[model samples]
Target: MFRSLCTTALLVPLLIVSTTASANPEVDRMFAEQDANRDGVIDQAQARAEATRVFRALDVNRDDERVIAELDPQIASGSPGGDGFPPDIHVVLRQATMQLRDVDGDGRITRAELQQAFVDGLLKADHDGDGKITRAKLIRMHQGVVSPAR
Candidate 1:
């Protein structure tokens, strides 16, 4: 009984944190964009496509690669004119995107790495073991409630 109480105490905060952390409209928009078919879920292929789109957008020089300088401006813009996400939300997504796409850890994002990162993200968001991620699952992931899909 004591152990159960302690476990419940620990889990309650986590549940609250998870839900609150994911309650951003901009973040929701970004994830929703990945649902290419508009079926309300993001699959691996869709993730790959979105990642590719982001990679291209950030690769301003069109050198087929990205550096911190290239990606920084977009984040710094703070969703200027509502064309992007606010700083708070954009920062997280940008960091995650870079982490996933920078395979060599050399501070550069490549096309191949970008593709893989989205696939990784898809797996991470697919809670309920459903092989697909709904908005709720994405929110749960943001809250840190579930581990990525296998």
Candidate 2:
């Protein structure tokens, strides 16, 4: 359960932090909303853009920061195909996401803090400390996790 929580906790925020801001609306549209290049890797620019977008969505009051009150509802809603977790998972998800993103323990999240969270998450996914989320590297990492060679 702990491992599941760790992986999904990281993945959920990563999913929420996906969008596009490039020219060629159709082409950008073709990619994952957060992956402007349709590649599995999310570089720093993409991470920042997506983090800013997600932060804006979470702010809800046009204020520059996110508080627990704003986050609770979104986590509780659990609408299918929306930004929510299962009812049973919301509490943990909220707690983990908050703990990671808050960065200051001041009970609020600024845009920069959220952006840094996203960038940091990308590094976690990188798995090789290359400062790059390359597809080949991720595949190798996944394979090692799935079936370690003797």
Candidate 3:
């Protein structure tokens, strides 16, 4: 009887954990969206496409690329009068953009540059050192839960 009670106690927590994780509606929706082929895993192509869509959305100028200037509106919108965000935000974005793009430092953002930028940006946004960035993390960053690491 004691052994059975111990097993029940241990399994109860495990079951609760599994149930809680499975109950997250947002995760379920995201999984459905990302599982384009319904294969239950997001392959590289899907990840890349999702990243590309995000990059394009942030590329306010519709120039097919994101530059430091392109992020101004985003920063501004969050700040008073849309005046602009802290200089630090600009500096980080600028340096990150340059590091991702400007491989040649030629002052022009090319297609390759944009691709690299998206990859790098995705990595930066992925907090908790996890390989994947969940919707919660993205929302937290957007809400400034943590200043983005350049």
Candidate 4:
């Protein structure tokens, strides 16, 4: 009984510290940027803004449309970049994201299409259709609860 108590005491603090330290600062910064209003959630306006920003980044040639290559040059080339994701998972995710964004079968996603996708996706993630997405919703989306269909 004494040994069990001693072990639990040692492990409890370690577990608490691990949980507290597990948060990714980079992820927090990005999430904060998305939160905009700092309301602990992202609303439609913020989601649309993020979509526009992403479209601008993807439309490198400023063509107002995103080709497969523009989405991720490395993934399109079948040679993943140092984006930390395993090559297979990165390629699959990019493919799924492309499919979700590209409504037209023409193989390109236009700026408007991207924005619409964001709106639609946010609507789907909003569950209650309240026009707001909480961090829990975002976490669920990230965990593939909604999958690529989002």
The per-model lDDT (C-alpha) reads 0.60, 0.58, 0.47, 0.56
Considering summed lDDT, which 10 consecutive residues are worst modelled in model 3?
A: 8-17
- What is the alpha-carbon lDDT for the whole of candidate 3? 0.47
| TM-score (C-alpha) between model 2 and the true structure | 0.62
> Over the stretch 1-150, how does candidate 1's per-residue lDDT look in tens digits?
322222221222223335567355634664556677888777777767766766666566899988765655555443445356766776775675466458889888787876775666556656666667777776776566666336
**Model 2 over residues 1-150: C-alpha lDDT tens digits?**
222223332453444333432322322331254576766665778877877776766566888998766667555444345556765787786777789889999998899998888776555446555566554443333333211221
- Badly placed stretches (over 4 Å) of model 4 are 1-30, 74-94, 143-150
Would you list the clashing residue pairs of candidate 1?
Answer: 18-143, 123-149
The pairs that clash in candidate 3 are: none
Ranking by lDDT: 1, 2, 4, 3
What ranking of all candidate models by TM-score puts the best one first?
1, 2, 4, 3
Q: Give per-model TM-scores.
A: 0.64, 0.62, 0.42, 0.61
RMSD in angstroms between candidate 3 and the native structure over all alpha carbons = 16.1
lDDT of 1 at 115: 75
Alpha-carbon error at 91 in model 1, in Å? 12
Q: In candidate 3, how many Å is residue 99 off? A: 1.8
Q: In model 1, which regions exceed 4 Å deviation?
A: 1-24, 79-100
RMSD (CA, Å), each prediction: 12.0, 9.4, 16.1, 13.8
- Which one is best on TM-score? 1
Which candidate ranks first by lDDT, i.e. highest?
1
Off by over 4 Å in 2: 1-31, 37-40, 77-89, 137-150
Q: Which model, 2 or 3, shows the larger lDDT?
A: 2
